[model samples]
Structures are given as structure tokens and as C-alpha cells.
Target: MAARPLDVAFKALAHPDRRRLLDLTREETSVGELVNATGLTQPAVSQHLRTLREARLITARSDGTRRLYRVDTELLDEVRRYLDGFWTDRLGRLKAVAETIDDGTTP
Candidate 1:
């Protein structure tokens, strides 16, 4: 079976360098700028950017002779939705326990 989009996004985000790239892309930037910010070689930065693009986590647009890249927040919203389930479940359980304790229902 093929990996789901969320799975692909998670895999792409597994690398610290890729995560750093995402952080740096809070504003649109060029590959060369990313390389300088990351202190990574051009090839390495390109490789990471390619993976991020494939995962739909980032987008590139041609500007004059340069390509500007930025985070694709809509796709990132999917990732956030997927991760939120775990936190939501845990928080719900904690809230229930807290309510039980407040009601003197814990034994």
C-alpha cells in the first residue's frame, strides 16, 4: 500500500535539517538564502527543499531569475490536524480525571 500524505509529510519532517528549512521559510526565501542560513552546501539544501516540496510542505515560485520558496500552510494544517488528535485525546482524558477528582469520584 502507498503511504498516506500525512505519512509522507511526517517522513519529510523527520530530518532536523528539513525542519530547520521549514523554520527559516516563515518568510519567502531563495534557495541560496536558505543555504546561507543553514550553513549547508547548495546541493544539500536543494535536496532538502526537494523533499519538502514533494511532501507539499513548501512551494516554489519563479521570480525573475530566482526561485522563491515558502511554507504551504494549508498542507501544514493537515499535519496539525493529524497530530492534534493525539493531544486532544490525552487532554480529554486528563480533563475527565480532573473532573472525577474534583467530584471525589477517584478511589
Candidate 2:
């Protein structure tokens, strides 16, 4: 993902409450259900949902009088790929350090 998009995804996930909301909405949920489950006000849930949608982490569908939200798999894939880069680099550094230690570089 682009730098701006990465920033948006990170910011959206920076909140514990938003993360919980995403967990609860993993299988499609409505705003009312999320508010009830999280004990947050409707407006608060709506605001979080808006952020998630804006970050492309969640998708919404209108169902009669209510709108249901679901996680966006493709968006998550992009986020995962971005994070995986860090993992790959960290693991490589760790391996190098381990090899050096084994070579008597330091105790």
C-alpha cells in the first residue's frame, strides 16, 4: 500500500475500541449491534465505522433500513503484506545476530 494508505490503516487500528468493533463485525454486523455489544453510543459506533470504512478496512451494505458492515479481505491482505516486510527484515537481523553470537562475537 501507499504511505498515506498505510498511515490510515494504522491510525484506524490504533484504537482498542475500534479493534474490538472490528472483531465483533468480522461476520457482518449492524451499527446497533456493535453499539450494544461495545456499550458505546450509536454515534460513537457510527464514527468508528466511518473511520474503518474510510480506511477501507470495512465494507458496508444497506439492508432495508439498516446498514451492515463486514471486514474487507483485500484491504487486510494489503495491510498484512506491508507488515510482513517488517517481519522479514526483523527475522533476517535476528538470524544474523544469532549467527554472530554462535561465532563467539559475544557471550
Candidate 3:
């Protein structure tokens, strides 16, 4: 069985190195720059980049001899919206429960 898109994205984000890579891409960046920022080997950074690319979280473009990467925010926005909805719903429920308690009603 294959992992869902959301699952793949979350899995890609689960690694500290991958998260750091994403953070570093706020500006267009190269694998060399990523390696320098992360202290990982070029091949190791490439591996993480491959995972992020597969997850649709980052996009790469060739610039002469170097491949520059940037975060593709659409998928990230989708993930953020999903998480926001989850939290909003849960917090709304919690607020209702608190209001009930304040009213001296059993929850």
C-alpha cells in the first residue's frame, strides 16, 4: 500500500534535517548552500531534497551548473489549512466544555 499525500508530506517534515532544509529555502538556495547550512554531505542533502521534492513541498530549478530550490507553498498551505481546521474544531469544543463548566453543568 502507498502512503497518502498528507502522510508523505508529514513524514518528510518529521525529520529535523528536512525541516531545516525547508527553513533555509526562504530564499532560493543551492544544494551546496544547504550542505553548508546543515553540515550534511552533498549527497545527504540531495537525499533529503529528493524526499521533499517527492512530497511536493519543494521545487527545484536548474540555474546554469547549479540547481536552485524553493519551497512550493501551495501544498504547505493545504497542510496548514488542514491543521488549522483540526485545531479550530478542537478548540471550539474545548471552549464549549469550559463554558458548560462555568455554568456549573456537568460535561
Candidate 4:
């Protein structure tokens, strides 16, 4: 069976290294630059980039010998929308409970 998009995204984001890589890619970066910035080995940085690519969280383009990577904001927005639904509902319920308490109402 294939994994869901959200599951894949969450898995990709589970690692701190991967998250850091994503943050660095916000401005279109190469593997060498990532290694220099994060103090990680080239192979390790590449591995994180590969996972982010698979998750569609980042995009890559070849600029001659160097491959540039950038964050995929649309995908991140989709993930955020999915997570926001839960928070919105939870906050709404919490507000209702608080209002009830203020009114001295018991359920």
C-alpha cells in the first residue's frame, strides 16, 4: 500500500536534520552550501535532501553542475491547512467551555 501524503510529509519532518535542511533551502541552496552551513557531511546532507524531495517539501533544479533546492511553499501550506483544522476545532471547544464556566453553568 502507498503511504498518505501527510504521513510522508510527517516522516520527512520527523528528523531535525531534515527540518534544518528545509529551512536552509528557503533561499535556493546547493548540497555544498548546506554542508557548509550545517557542519554536516556531504553524504548526510544529501540524504536529507533526498527525503525532502520524496516528500514534495522541497524542489530541485540543476544549475549546470550544481543542483539548487528550494522549499515548496504550496505543499507546506497544504500540510498547515490539514493541521489547522484540528486546532481550530479544539480552540472553539475550549472557548465554549470557558464561557460556560464564566456563566457558572455545570454540564
Encode model 4's per-residue lDDT on 1-107: one tens digit a residue.
79988789899999999999988988989889999999999999988899998999999999999999999887778877978998999999999999989889654
Q: Give the alpha carbon lDDT tens digit for every residue of 1-107 in model 2.
A: 55687688889999998899889988989998998899999999999999989988889999999999998777778877979999999999999999988899555
Would you list the rank order by lDDT, best first?
3, 1, 4, 2
For candidate 1, list the clashing residue pairs, or say none: none
Per-residue C-alpha lDDT of model 1 across residues 1-107, encoded as one tens digit per residue? 89888889889999999999999998999999998999999999999999999999999999999999998888878767878998999999999999988889646
lDDT of 3 by residue, 54-91 (tens): 99999999999999999988887887899999999999
Candidates' TM-scores? 0.74, 0.72, 0.74, 0.74
Name the candidate, 1 or 2, with the larger TM-score value. Answer: 1
Worst 10 residues of 4 by lDDT: 73-82
For model 1, the local distance difference test gives: 0.93
Pairs with backbone N, CA or C atoms under 3 Å apart (clashes), candidate 4: none
Per-residue error for 27 in candidate 3, Å, reads: 0.7
